[model samples]
Target chain A: MDFGAMVDYLPLFEQAMWLTLRIGWIGILGSLVIGLVVAMITHYKIPVLYQISLFYIELYRNTPLLIQLFFMYFALPRVLGVGIDAEACGMLGLALLGGAYMAESFRSGLEAVEPIQTESALSLGMTKAQVMRYVVLPQAVSLSVQSFVANIIFLLKETSVFSAISLMDLMFVAKDLIGLYYNTTECLVLLVIFYLIIILPVSILGTVVERKLRYGAFGS
Target chain B: MELLGLDVLFKGSNAMRLLQGLGVAVEISIISVVISLVLGMLFGIFMTWKNPVARVISRIYLEIVRIMPQLVLLFIVFFGATRALGLNVSAELSSIIVFSFWGVGEMGDLVRGSLESIPVHQYESAAALGMTKGQIYYHVVIPQAVRRLIPMSINLVTRMIKTTSLILMIGVVEVMKVGQQIIEANRMVSPNAVFGIYGTILLLYFLVCWPISMLARHLEKKWSN
Candidate 1:
């Protein structure tokens, strides 16, 4: 409601947005790496590691990201006797939680590649690794693109919880501004706009990519 | 070594407080889920209606819900509304309002999907059999949609329950909040209690959510057949 207050706090929100993007991007990248490894392990059904990956996936997926962050930020240091900063804890927690959901998305995508395609590739004298590299993964990646986008958006939104861990992400800035100025409407309106700015482009791009993928694959 | 820290849970009435916290979380989830189901059913039906305005409105609602984080929505409703709208909404009430708002979007989509999935021929056949529009929907469409709706809605329930953890941020004293309180109180008496207490809370969430997810999977598999 107060335009002047919102304008005055724009700089703070900008800084918070940058922090959010920095941590969210790094966290998403970490999750992508971890997810790929877990997906591969489960896809190949590797001994011992497969079970561990499955447990990791389920344990992370079934719990809230807030708890995971709290445990990592508040509890892990006490147990491990090492100090982890709030930002590191936020990034790590995001990765751990995002990894599980991404793994599920990737695994499903990998599974969606037809068995017949793999069989033919194998019979064509392609090694398993070559078949996976050339034939299966490309198709699987395309199939899972939508879910991957969804997971990315989900994880990014989850960065909101970093405020709870005392990280000055966008949400934290909004809450802090509100606490300081009592401009609840202004702070919250800015919060919503900032989030939309961050999320809308990804969401729009995701739709475009999905349409292209569908058309490219189906000739529709 | 870490097991000793769990002794804090057994000391005094700490465990009871936790169960109470869990109850609050569950209570919030149940209330919102019920509200969402009823409201979402209507929203879903409206979405599927042959009205461009309705479709556009629902689409915008869904997109807004999807784009904004639930935490932000909670803050807006809990903090912003009290100031802007001059409404004296309690934390729990605001939480329910936000959750139900979110659930309606989700559950409405589910309803729309299930309703759309009902074959066109079934509606035609019912019409041919001299059934009124209401009768067609009641006798033919809803029954089939409910079947598909059940498993997905159950999954939504689990999602809602997990998301209720966010309410603790706004000071709802849910399970996570209670766990934090217990850890803070026992920080000195049991420094290691941090790990045990949070780990226990993690386990408690797992216990509450895993079975529900499993059941959703079970129903999905069963109904798919």
Candidate 2:
């Protein structure tokens, strides 16, 4: 295709990449926090909060992130009578959607810790919170590491949709360039390459980490 | 009251348009799922074959599909192909192509995993009984593999359906696009209509996906035992 056009558009794509990474990292962190809290609530089976967390997870997990983004960006502002910008809406929507998936991952991790481990810790006169911290959380974190990496990648790919809400993410920049110059091939090639640049390292690193964890767990 | 914005849905043909939009989304999902299932099964078998070339090619294909965002793939197929290769692919066709490309990778992996999960002794025993390779797969392996395959593929179907929402970007008038059209048309008359319209669209997707996922979970539980 057109190498010249691609080179000319590099700066715009760079700017968009930074915006995407900034929002993606923040959304990833936000989802991790929300996921951890929700997983804890469900794991401990807290009275009302447990049910609420389950509902939240199910609702978010089942619905499309695009619709969630639309509802937050377009609908929420009208209903709440407050203005929310596209970037903020993108970050918020990603966090909420990613949170549900992360919660499920973490919950499965937490459940994977054997009952005997908790029982032995409890019999040792350790407090419930202490047992959770010392006995359960560490193991659970290790177990959930692979899924966490997966969820992170999933969330980052989802940042592509942020364009719909008018965020100038990589996809937005590519579409904008194509609209202006009709360089669809150049723009799309750049889009795919940039996405691979963002995603491939994480995926490779994830596989390495998962293998290491497997060896560490099984002594194989 | 106008505050809730539910009135907009009842007015004129808004509700009908939404249903039609839902139909388009479902239509794409079903077509893509069918194509992926058949092709992915073959790909899955190829993956399990004892050939280095097939192994390396399948690995690269799977990784590429996994690493690239589906939206970028969609843009490439829908926008780039039209200009670069001078192929006139419609939005719906492009969506099906991208989704099936994605689905095949996912389903192929699922098939390979389930196929590999069946123990070696089962194959040996069937061989000892003098069954042909094709018969072995049809009678012994496939029956067991189907158990694991069903629940996971159901999950994939739900994932594919949810992902069809992305087609709206390429200008496919799917459910999300219809919701946007309704809100834009009523923006002045009912500024709050955005809330109801999008919320309804969200509910519609939830309704479509939730039961299928539930069935998947149920099947996994039942079959696992």
Candidate 3:
């Protein structure tokens, strides 16, 4: 299985892993912001913005992340007449796609918060924006933390697709290693294990967070 | 003007290729969904049953499917499986196998959730009524579980449909692949054609998936209430 070559490639894979992590984290944060915004806009049912947010969520969620990445990498540049680095394109694709799911998660979280809390905050003379920002978003985010984490992991898995656009992510490195070494089995095994290493700890952490939140770790 | 390459759709064989691709995509999604549901149900049953080996096996399968990307799995099934098993398999067949493997994990988890959600009293009452294990499952548990399962399963189906786009990466001539082909063929001739072809592909996917998603949401709402 050319185990020696696999070992020799670890340095390269480590670099690629860093790139993947960089892009994945950027996508996660970007999507969180986008998701929260869209969720809020729609939750309040703003006249035209609500419909636009709904369209954005449905369109992104329904389509494959692969094509979305392609659109960002290939079509967007030509349409806008500008060059975008593969890394930025990959991050943007993941962020946009992740945003849709995040929006749904955030929306559900917003729905989960008791209406009386909002009413009481308003009665206390707080603005709607202030109530949402201070009282509602905290509880809503805590409630949806588990699903939000799962979505993050899903976005991480999706960063693998960026390899198709020639991004120097872990999956792309693994494919390159396979081509260079002609040792498919070892490369594939290493790729799977690499992903497992990244994903398992995050999933365990998600479980712990969910448990803590349920137990009022962040304040009920 | 070119209407931003809208003319490409009315051009030669472009639209036909897309329709054909859509047919293939739908075909793969349907066949894989059916197989996945059947096997996933069995796995779900094993997951809930009181057997150590079965439970462990089911758990491992579920985790692997959940954690791995479908692209990786498709590669493994298409490239790894064929070589390891000493078999010749077409890309479409390989895609179905991979998708079904993923489907089993997802659908099985849904089934497990549905089964677990059934109240304890339901089982106890069935047992008290002199029902055997099989009879209790058939008459008492499954009927109730079906309500939860239907909506969740439909959601999975929509997911499978969207995910099938990944099959093109492994050389399957599905909708996404067809879109790429048309775009490649027209890239130089019409600058706007690239956007136009892909726009069509996106619209096609939205048309197919949006309805299913709406239906699944409707089911979820109806069943939950």
Candidate 4:
């Protein structure tokens, strides 16, 4: 398994892991913003914007993330005449791709909130924005906690695709280390462990949140 | 002529190469889907079994698949496993193996969820009718589970097809890989080859996946009614 080779490569792996986490966090936060906005657009059923959001959701969701990354990394720069660094391009691709799925998840969550809740909030003299801000968004978040967490796990795993663009992420580092030492198995094990360290807690938290939302005192 | 840099998609051999790549994608997807479905069904049944060992094994399998990215899993098998095991597995074969194992986890969960969703009364009624366990599963449980399973399984098939794009990263000459090659080959002559080629691939994928999703939704509506 070339344990010594893996030990020597530990620092490199750590750096790459940090990069992966950075890209993942950036993508996660970006998607949350995009998902919330697009989901609300659909929820409000605004004429033109609703249609655009629907098309965006279907277009992104239907295609592969790799293709999306390729388009953004390769085509967008050519068309826009602007150079983008690998890190920025990778993060942008993940954000746009993850946003689509998040939009779907958020849309379902928003729909699960009852129309009556909004109506009562309105009748109580709250503006539409305030109603959505308070009554709908909080309950919707609680209701879709499971899907929200699932989307996070998905976003985390997807950061690996950034390696294709040479983003210096964990996967790219592992591949480079393997190329150097030919210790493919050891490097692979280390790769899995690095990801598991990150992913396991999130998944366990997902289950915990799901249970809490379902049976906890808040009482959905 | 260059309408948003999409005109190159219809130019010359680009279309043919992409079609060829699409064929490879479909071939890999079909092979993986068939293999995964068979194993996935068994895994699903095993997951729901009462035996402690069976349950633990299935749980571990499910968690590993859930936690790991598909691309990393591909790297592990193609690069890691082949070296460690001293075997010369082709990229296509490794993809099949990874996707099958992945399919087992996803499909098994779907099966488990659908099986659990069946009301307890169905089983009790079968028992009261003097049906043996095998008869109960064959006649009662399987039928009801199949109803709930078909739509989700179809969705899984579409997912497998879409995810097959990942195989390209491992050196498999699938649709996206072909598109890349075309873009590189035409980089000098056609400035918009990247847009044209990838846009076409995107449309091709949309064509394939959108219908399957629609079909799944249709079946869900039909069966629920």
Best by DockQ: 2
Candidate 1 per-residue C-alpha lDDT over A19-120 given as tens digits, one digit per residue, 9 for 90 to 100? 999999899999999999999999989999999998999899889999888888888887677999898888889998989999998898887777888899
Summarize candidate 1's per-residue lDDT along B31-131 as a digit string, tens digits.
99999999999999898988888888999999988999999999999997899789899999999999999999999999999999998999999999999
**Docking quality (DockQ) of candidate 4:** 0.70
Native-referenced DockQ of model 2: 0.86
| DockQ per candidate | 0.75, 0.86, 0.65, 0.70
lDDT string for model 3 (B1-225, tens) is 274677878888889989999899899999999999999998888789888988888888888988898888887777777667878888999889989989999999999999999999999999999999999999999988998999889889988998888887778888778888887787777777777777778888889989998998998888785
The best-first sequence of candidates by TM-score reads 2, 1, 3, 4
Per-residue lDDT of B1-225 in model 2, one digit per residue for the tens?
589788899999999999999999999999999999999999999999989999999999999888888999999999988997899999999999999999999999999999999999999999999999999989999999999999999999999988999999999998888888898999899988888999999999999999999999999999985
lDDT of 4 by residue, A1-220 (tens): 6678878888988898889888888988999899998998888899999999989988888887877887788777777788789888878888888788888888877877778888889999999899988888888877778888988998898888887777888888888878887878888989998999778899999998888776312533
RMSD of 4: 2.2
lDDT value for candidate 3?
Answer: 0.85
Task: Give lDDT tens digits, candidate 2, residues A86-146.
Answer: 8888888899999999999999988878888889999999999999998888888888888
Q: Write the residue-wise lDDT of candidate 4 on B24-81 in tens digits.
A: 9888888988987888888888888999999888888899999999888999989977
Docking class of 2: high
Could you give candidate 4's fraction of true interface contacts?
0.76
lDDT of 4: 0.85
TM-score of each: 0.95, 0.96, 0.94, 0.93
Pairs that collide in candidate 2 are none
Give the DockQ ranking, best first.
2, 1, 4, 3
- Per residue, candidate 3 scores C-alpha lDDT tens digits across A99-217 of 99999999998888888888999999999889988999888888888889889888888877878789887778776776676677777887887888778888888988888776223
